[model samples]
Target: MNSLWSGSERVRIVERLKATLAGVVELELLRCKHLEMVDAALEDRASAAANAAELPAEEGIRAPGSTASEAEHGSTTSRRQQVSAILKVIRGHIGACVGPVFNPLLSPSLSPGYDFAAVLEWFAERVDRIILLFDAHKLDISDEFSEVIRALKNHEDKMRVVLNKADQISTQQLMRVYGALMWSLGKIINTPEVVRVYIGSFWAQPLLVPDNRKLFEAEEQDLFLDIQSLPRNAALRKLNDLIKRARLAKVQAYIISSLKKDMPSVFGKESKKKELIANLGETYHRIEKEHQISPGDFPNLAKMQELLNAQDFTKFAALKPKLLEAVEDMLANDIARLMAMVRQEEAAMPSQTVKGGAFEGVMTGPFGHGYGEGASEGIDELEWVVGRDKPTYDEIFYTLSPINGKVSGAAAKKEMLKSKLPNTVLGKIWKLADVDKDGLLDDDEFALANHLIKVKLEGHELPAALPEHLIPPSKRGSSLEA
Candidate 1:
């Protein structure tokens, strides 16, 4: 994968992560605080429901203890019980998984303080895509690494497998290698669909076997295009992940609630727990039938059973219908609204294209023109400076800086973010754009910055400094005014 950040920014991220990792006492405190917050939220929701229940009925409506009221009350109680059961299950798991221990031997390095699970979660939230590179010649997957990959099943959508060093072997051999790789991965990744894999020799050397060169080039282009789309679809990906998590949580609550209900209150709890674990398949079907949950939503049977074996069923909370209803509402309504907003924002965004990489001329601008094609009209003129794009850039500048016709460094940074250029590249563009060195951008500077961004996006090199003719005509001989 390409490095997203410059050297300095990468260092800063490591420092931030190091600081975020706390000592044992601090971690314990944080765990307690998190539980308290959960309790407070549950209390708030219960109080709201109670208040709504107390509200007087309309003049011609039914009174307390009516069939409708009793039904609503029972539903709410059932939901509360379910919520408690889910919490018990969650708390039990959390209690068993202790934080990283502080080791004296790893003094200078901070690896001792890093919790692998915590670090993985942090990186998953920030990173858009994860490419798992494999050497085509070696198709074996170690048990330890396979387990690690299996743990990331939740984020499998973000994963892309790359079969590298394909050029080292003949096309016939490549086919056999690819088949072996897929067979190995199928044993590890528990999914019905096949994982996407890109086969290419990803290096600066010549291909030893040129028969499949075109195929490799096409595969490389597809991989780069997939990486390029990450920024545009990030919001949607996040929303989708959230929805997936909610569905899984709801399924887990159902399973736990069913188990809790099956356990005897005063006796046979241990034997009942054993029986439940032994017949987990039946329990899963029963829960699915009773709650109308899809079978696909259920977690792996073996993993779920192993977790339950360590848990005490009697302590699990009863099923709470209201809690489940809230989750259902969020999945149905709240997430739907968020998805609509994301689509709206995407619809409003101007079309963009990545001009360089394994393929060229793959995409064109609004007028079906590729980069550097503006010169075909008979004169050598920079597109942003002489083409119809200037006015549009100016309009965007005004939108970003409405008040005084100038944008602060921060504001310009915010607008430039939409271009999805690397921060290192943007820093260079900013330096070239701020002609008069005022640290803020007037309309002209903003336009220049955007033009450079377009140049970079089109796979052209950026100049070390702004050229005289390329400079905005209005800002030509002015000092500290451009």
Candidate 2:
């Protein structure tokens, strides 16, 4: 068996497990709430029944010969059933507050027709923010992720990337990957502002392997502070879902009423039904554009319809009070409970992690010792600081194109270079950078290429920390803007 296949299989299995675990934890929380709601509803109903029982027989209970009290009792029973159905609707909607990347194999409705992009857009509508997480061992942004970054640049205010599993790599490796990641992110988002990148193991505890024992032990709180901070949306997302529910309730009432118009009925009852229908029409028109949400957004609408129709809502007019009460409970307690939890978690978190890396300029360290530095340094202060060993030409190539090191034997590297540079300029870059006729760029060559991109193509000054000798002839005597 191929070792790579086994490792990939393990990863797939682990992803499935995580998705399943998330589903279980969320459902368990909801189930507990359901049990509590059921007990409260039952207790309240029992108290009401007991109160009725305590009333004088002549006042509360109809005499065996009279039917008015029996009719009232039936209405009360029907209302209780309506309350139960409404509770289910509230429960179903509460779990989907954020997008859960569900497996299509588990349920097609999650990524319906396997259109994950469309599903992602659907999720984008619901969420106020997005977390883009990746492993620290391989922090290089790939082509696929570049597309995501570009697509989400519109929501850049809400974006933050978590570089997880830092404990899996060495300090030197972590620092190198971190520098590369920041550079890649700057290019992707097309921004000078540094991207927020939380660096730590996201697991309960960082594995104390020899690879990262030093940094893992040094950072006390680890990723907890950052994870807690990521969800800090300024305002709680006020879903216009309430309007949709109101529209839905009115539509259902109208439909149920219209279905009864042809039936044999007393003139007085028929007139009342027509009046209620007209009122519902007016209410629907008033709220039609109040919210862009629709009943179609809820996946289990078929089941919900069954639940709504499951009871004897034939007396729905009488049951509206209980239905409304259930909605009120959901708004006050159920939805509030979850939103409050998120807000409290955010509030309790210490203000340490950077949100979107507002203040973090390009960081440089020991790897850039030979790099130039002087008083009043500006752009040059940002140095190439990967490690003690200078980066290789192949490393630079691989960084530019994932296909560079692949066994598939593709000309992806050439294509990548072309994409970044014009033919006339690229030929000049090749002559200056690749000093050896070996068709590869070494550290000197790599630095030269970067300098070309920064100065010539991007019209940005080369980092002043770059060794003065490495500066191309054209940029040597030119004065740079701060």
| Best-performing candidate as measured by TM-score | 1
Clashing pairs in 2: 380-463, 380-464
> What is residue 245's positional error in candidate 2, in angstroms?
5.1
What C-alpha lDDT, on a 0 to 100 scale, does residue 424 get in candidate 1? Answer: 98
RMSD of each: 23.8, 21.9
Query: Cα deviation of 287 in candidate 1 (Å)?
Result: 0.5
Candidate 2: stretches off by over 4 Å: 1-44, 48-200, 203-482
Report the C-alpha lDDT of model 1 over 1-482, residue by residue, as the tens digit.
01445788657644543332222223334334534655677689979986775655545666567776686667656755664675467441211211112122124433223334433454554456766778777655665456456556566666788898899899999999999989988888778888999999889898988898867866876887786676677679877866766677677767777787888889777888899899999988888888788887787898678556656677665565665666676676656655776777876777554445433644444323223332222124543353347688888777774557788998899989999999999999999888878898988788878877887886666766676655666677784354
| Residue 140 CA displacement from its true place in model 1, Å | 2.9
TM-score, candidate number 1: 0.47
